[model samples]
Target: MAKRRKAKQRESRAPRFWGQHAVLAALENPARTIRKLWATHDAIAGIDVPPDLQVEMAGVADLGRLVPQDAPHQGLVIEVEPLADIAIEDLLAGAGDGRPLVILDQVTDPHNAGAIMRSALAFDALGLVTQDRHAPPESGALAKAASGALEILPWCRVVNLARALDQIAEAGFWRIGLAGEADMDLADALGGKRIALILGAEGAGLRPNVASHCDALARLPISDRIESLNVSNAAAIALYAAQNSQESR
Candidate 1:
């Protein structure tokens, strides 16, 4: 009996996911394969969850047993496998009406990336492009910051960002590099056929090669009083500018 109990214990020790939005989105998505679910009686009562999915009604400690002690599961936890990453070529091919795409050049911070993703989705941008090596691994913090958008947005990790920009240009995207020192303002750089808003790390801004790859260098029209806007905020402003310009025409 002890051996059987130990076997059951091993089965229960799986990676559990939390966050109401994350779990609910996962549950609603038919493509998402959920392994197990643990929720308090009150929390489960709130949702019209499917009957076929495995469920357990338990206390907070029961959820503690499923996930890390530090996790803020908010009365529920779900164990699921990671979804597959999307391809850049497929994303470009699938572009319906030439919406803008945002490219990250070694912007490694997960919080910044996730925040940028949230903004991207809000502006109805095409998708995101990042280097696989420099970017952060997908985790709870990023997912939380994205507010359920991390799952929906297509983050295309490519081998080289500059090379990817070259591909994007060939695919008919006009690359616009955002740099503080740039002579051209963002609005002046607008009216392009298709824009790839290329950005880089905050202090360093866009690298020389990365800047060289872009068709034009543009700056946000802000006073020189501040050093610079946060990279994610810059991205938001740029995306907004792009959309606003497109709508005006």
Candidate 2:
């Protein structure tokens, strides 16, 4: 039917994920829709895919042609639709006491976002919030960097990050902006039952508007030997610090 043709057209243009983690995660996520899957014989042997789903057997070279150059597909590639969007309200509604939130401002790089997602999942953070216009779309590079975190993490894209921060505050989250210029330390800012950790894009740092929305601004305790840590690394450290702070109390 016409609907099936349109669906096929959408799948043709949709993103293709490769690698064992990314492909397998996509397959495992019920929210994900896999259109076309191709895998090498050796790779397929270890995978227990749905019996009803048609899978194409391919060689390593054939799978290589499906993804970006030198992407390390690990003998798998699959066409898929982007996961459905999550509303910020729903994200906040799901937050529990002591669970942290990671909010990104203008962090456009997919690698950093992916790594942050990985950290958020590792720390059991409530969710990730980002400006809809400033964040990268789901892609193979991101999924690869996240190591499967992208499929499971609750991600919220909003029109205005500052406005979203206000909603976050109204929901009883004490917002802490990670600003190198702030005199406050991250540990001191973790006073509330729930914490909302905000980070910004590298180089530019937090915008004035977003910074204004924060309840307090805190910086990581890093030596001057390095100007600053990578956003993802900083997020991991901060999340770890938050966890320790919560557990010690």
User: What tens-digit string does per-residue lDDT give for candidate 2 at 1-249?
Assistant: 000111212123789888999999999987778888998888888688988777999998888888888899999898888877777887888776678999999998988999999999999888899987789888888899899999888888889999999999998888989999889889888884688899999989999999999999999988999899999999999999888877888
**Which parts of model 2 are misplaced by more than 4 Å?**
1-12
> Which pairs of residues collide in candidate 1?
none
Q: What Cα-based lDDT does every candidate model obtain?
A: 0.79, 0.86
Task: List RMSD in Å for every model shown.
Answer: 7.8, 4.5
Q: Give the candidate number with the greatest TM-score.
A: 2
TM-score of 1: 0.84
lDDT of 1 at 178: 94
Position 191, candidate 1: lDDT = 66
Each prediction's TM-score against the native? 0.84, 0.93
Q: Pick the lDDT winner.
A: 2
Distance from true location, Cα of 105 in model 2, Å: 0.4
Q: Write the per-residue lDDT of candidate 1 for residues 116-156, one digit (tens) a residue.
A: 99999999888898887887566655665676776677777
